[model samples]
Target: MKIKDRVIELLSDKYCGLLPIKSIHEEDTIIDIGFDSLRFMEFVVLIEEEYHIEFPDDLLDIQSTTTVREVIERLEKEV
Candidate 1:
């Protein structure tokens, strides 16, 4: 699946549909989409497992304001 689709799926599952995936925009930050620190960390873990890549430690410093598009861009670079 495309990275964006997979991200939506993972988040939708994790949040139990609390997140309205269809309403999310590429530029929207995780916090803007209702993800707190714990939820974001869980999402990161899912991304790591799905891509079979360990994110750099510096990634943990990513701001909550980081956009979905930015995250996808970073993941694509890793791939």
Candidate 2:
């Protein structure tokens, strides 16, 4: 699957079950989806496992505020 589609699937399964995938926009940040610090970390780890890549230290700190578009861009690079 495309990175964006996988992301939406992950988010839907792991966090926002009630929110439809169609409602999630690339411009939406993790926090915009109601992810707190704990959920954010869980998601980061999930993505890392899915892609077999550890996120860089710099990216970890700002991830909660990073938009889905930016996340997809970074994930594409990592993968």
Best by TM-score: 1
RMSD of model 2 against the true structure: 2.3
Q: What local lDDT does model 1 show for residue 68?
A: 74
Q: What would the per-residue lDDT of candidate 2 be over residues 19-74, giving only the tens digit for each residue?
A: 56877788988678666666667777888788888876666755556887887787
Residue 2 in model 1: shift from native, Å?
Answer: 1.4
Best by lDDT: 2
Shift in Å, residue 51, candidate 2: 1.3
Worst 10 residues of 2 by lDDT: 11-20
lDDT of 2 at 5: 90
Off by over 4 Å in 1: 13-17
RMSD to the hidden true structure, all candidates: 2.2, 2.3
